[model samples]
Target: MDSPVQIPFKSFIQLDSKSATAIYLQIVFEFIKAIQLGFLPEGTKLPGSRILCRLLGVNRNTLIKAFDDLESQGFIKISASKGTFILSSQKQVVKKEGIRSLPNDLPVAVDFDFKKSNILDNPVEGSDLSLQFNDGLPDARLVHTDVLARLYVSKLKRNRNNGVWEQLQTQAHLNFKAQFCNYLNLTRGLKIAPLNLLTTTNHEISLFLVLKLLINAGDKVVVASPGYYFSNMSILDSGAQIISVTIDEEGINVINLREICKAHQIKVLYLTSVNLYPTTISLSAKRRIEILELAREYRFIIIEDDYDFEFHFDNNTVLPLAAIDTYKNVVYIGSFAKSLPAGFSYGFVSAPPDFIAELEKHQRILASGVDVIKEQVLTEWIEEGEVHRLAKKNKKIYKERRDYFVELLHLKLEGSIKFQVPNQGLAVWIEWLPSFSLIKFQKKCLDNGLFLPKTTLYQNKNLIATRLGFGSLNEKEMENAVAILQKSIAEVLIEIR
Candidate 1:
């Protein structure tokens, strides 16, 4: 097909061999000029590379190279099925006078309206139950904004007005990191240096930065099957091959991963070893040790997502593999986003000194570095005993909520719903099978103002289970939610029968 977004070659195929400019580059500039002139709109797809090569009467290699150069510069995008299309541009493209108007045969209008990739508009925003189950980040209502206000005020008053930029190695920043280390040592028993922890804006940024250092594009990484669906998206975005190891009731099937390791050279073994998603089972301690041993023998790294280590509402607290990774093979990841607060915007990566150095380099390259003062505030929270105090306070409140939710279920719908009381977690995993799909149950529950995420949100669409986040719902709300859920489940079962 001809280019929908076309640039009539204003200049002949002039091979300027004597000049420094390559012939392909000469053609590239002319094409760019057309795009700047409004000849190409947003939806307009460029001709096939072969067609472009033929029309320009240039070598196919040179044409393809020019196309690649344009793509890398963000002037155009190469879609999977739609071919190349004009990307958002800032400068204008000027066209020559007396050019014929756009052909009547062309359908797509070339508009340079740039926008970010589509974002999922969550219906949970501003929901009445929003405070209860919107576990994506720290609720603005919950964070102590006054603390942040003071910190930023200090920067303006002390640092900027004096013409002294805040030193990255200031005493405040260092103290914060040290306190973070102390929290880890106390909770997980891993005595990390404050310098070893690199606080990130969030988990997604943290994972992306770590993966860049540890994984080359197209390298093989292993993850638990039906795992955090988002992890698979992240891995694939990094251009890495994902090997899905089956997860059973005991968490990741370590035995199967080992067999895959024998068959293929794996780069990273990613697991949410702490209260893994969809199914709230942490890896057995024996398998945790076995996984690290395998890492040492196989020369790969273990990406441990201790995402919710603090909320384990159980006395027999499960240990994270990072706590016992004496060999430095485990890259420990912790996030306070789901644990205590959000907008503190902190998650950490704890690894060996070498990986830590490489991670800093990667941060510089990736621009996902932590804010110095935010780190300080968190460290102060730890030192001032706010974290532990908050944890202890929330524990009583959340545990009561969990117990109330469970008790209410027993009273309202005992035989129909089955779930486990997790050792320590805000959410409980439930399995229901008088043959009712969770989505069907969710739809029924939504009518009564009780909103919960179905298991399909975390795993494959076919998997039928539900995750009830009790941490966000209070005692009165818990009983109310339970009553609504009981009716919801009954409605689902009635349809199934």
Candidate 2:
């Protein structure tokens, strides 16, 4: 057996007086780490308490406490005469030649094999540039932060006064569910009880739960050609094979979809019907009726992701398919974050009561339950009409931004790009007419201090387009970004020539 003095205890057993962890616990942890890493193998005898205390420059009492803890935890055996011996069963084997020094950090790679998922890789990109564009995200600055802060604090105080915080796990916050259901009924034309709705932290989780419940491995799922990338990832990650259908001005090609239905058994058809992602076009009323009829005939679920339903600027806005889904085949997914500020968003699913009950089971496994305090805050926000008030206020601001952005695009790149002024959402889909590379344009934009995320760029053999979000950019920022975009296009065209 190697003597404790042969092992470099002073090197591996590091301690910090300023650390918040207790000194004795720190010593105990260091010893456990050393043993596990083979620095101190099983049967290695440790120095006496007094000797170690002197060597490590630690207090005698602290060293003794560490030894006591190690022995209690079965990592060491303390004897009256022989000395403390390492007793850890998990200790790695060490050579008898000498003690080798290793890095203090833990191993980075695991020794065992496990499954890896490339389908779940994140497609979202982030940037720290002062000027940037996204795929139609809400403006964080326009959110009512002060009002939300006050409401949250007041609710917390009231909960504390009534001793409700202690019972948070049990409190269901049914009032919020009732108010949410009522809000949907009035705004989106859905008649649902509190039990028919299920709330989640965000749209992705809500859709994930619904897909996991309905889809199985090798199941066939249909999505639009240039669909929402994140939702498509989720569908593929659930082990379902994705089938793409073309989308046009009217929305998804229902005629083509019916042909596909005739050929294969599709388990689900996921779409952003209200304002189609990237395109910002609504599924026409005629197409909505036809799609619903096909769903009834073929017995497939329609996941209508009406993510930005409240941000529609058009006067002739159409209601969601769920509003007129008499066959109960439409599973509607929506988010409240588009109306609120950055962190205060919540997502929900509207389905049958029985389906919701089944979803709750999966939700409990994923997240124990929704935050009771947040639910209460939203309940008060909805009941006092603050939610609607904010939605109305922000809609006016976003519409103005959209108009200004469209004007700038026309003024700067009239012949170089072609686009439609989207009437429903915060983004405008601009198709670039030039044959220059979109990737080269993105690189040039970055060099000029403007970041255009890869997710916002859509390119194929037939099309070169980008979804430029104006909601988050004010007039001055929009002007600057557009100038940079125009300059980058000119530079790319020069390179191509």
Candidate 3:
């Protein structure tokens, strides 16, 4: 247009004709990347679309589309009747006379230090593996993300006229809490009220809250050996001494727990009653009753994490111990993550009203409150019966996947691995033959584009097992992963031989 304004960015924008990404998107991405990489400084004007199109050998419409996207994404700015210029690469950086300056200038260099807790460790960064089984997570694709987004948007608009503070203090939270208690009552046979429930971001947070309330320094708490590592971490963070009881076919050994309780003044006992973590074995009905009786006699707390209550295969699966906790000793917690979409994690703890009140106080100090918007949308989903619908749908799909996965395991590595056909949950516990090392097998799998973490490998003095989840994988991914796993086992076995 006016003699085609010149720019130095011609070398930065390269288009791959055969790329799966659209040409316009490629241009937009390159320009944004250039800004991010600081090749283009703040307020540096981009070449005119006419000149850019001629330089890049792209259609004028395509160039314009790229320019529009860059401007819309805040990577660039276009002034009417003026040229397009790069936005400040750092949003916080100010542009003065074409020079970027921080809003707050540092007087001196600052160094930061952080102390690592013995309980909580840093998160493991993920690799670019082709497929990896998670710890019994639901298929995110099955979640009604579109419906949830629409519901959230509707709630936002409805709350637009209300003040932010008012919105925070709205009855939506109370309503959701009530609905959640009702859901628990119907499903778990627990007569819980809204006052007995406290909602957190996830089960971990709920568990932490319970531990904080119950555990004191050097106080004794029992956990299953090689159990939910995160829960054990929470207990340690709360300054509680741990007594690990072994888990068997019927879940954690109650006899061992009784011995530990007698030896130590046990304050808390954390267990997954429905489907134990890693090992999807439900605690027997008799053990559940015994544990409840022991808790009352010993005056200890039971933190029940029923994370996969909805995925049971049988109709008459044992009701949660909390349902029949006559002494009000159980702090029942459950996660919506197994039932809802990814990025949506909400959990509730149903305990005595006094415990909940204390937990609420601590929760207020930690976070302002539960996400009101999310709470409202979830309430709508519950009332509309979408949660139940989705849970039922997920259970059906997971059951099918579980069956197919177990079948594939048998077909592929029948003699190499021993496993129990689980009745519920998303994973199968595969115990390796005595000859093979799971560590070597895991490393080989990771080397072959499958990311099985060592933490997923449960090893004691003699036993080695792993929980390979199938809920998140489709048929094709599952097949490929199983094949890789089989090959990996063979490779490891050959090395040992």
Please, what is the TM-score per model? 0.69, 0.77, 0.76
Tens-place lDDT digits, model 2, residues 1-497? 34666666776676655332357656775786677556686778888888888888899988887787576556788889888888744322211112122444657468899985544544555555778898888888777788888988887777766655546635546777888899999889899998899988888889999999999999999988777868877888899988878888898999899999999999999989989987888899999999999999999999999988888786776799999999999999998756576456888999999999999999999887567777788888788888888888888999999989999999999899998888788899999998755656776787787888757877665678888988889999999999999999999899778
Per-residue error for 447 in candidate 3, Å, reads 1.9
Clash numbers, per candidate = 9, 0, 0
Q: For candidate 2, which ten residues in a row score worst on lDDT? A: 91-100
Global lDDT of each model? 0.66, 0.81, 0.76
Range of the 10 consecutive residues with the lowest summed lDDT in candidate 3: 93-102
Candidate 3 yields a Cα-based lDDT of 0.76
Give lDDT tens digits, candidate 1, residues 297-346: 99988998877776767788888888888888888887763544456657
In terms of lDDT, which candidate is strongest?
2
lDDT over C-alpha atoms for residue 385 of model 3:
88
Structure candidate 3, residue pairs in collision: none
lDDT of 2 at 127: 55
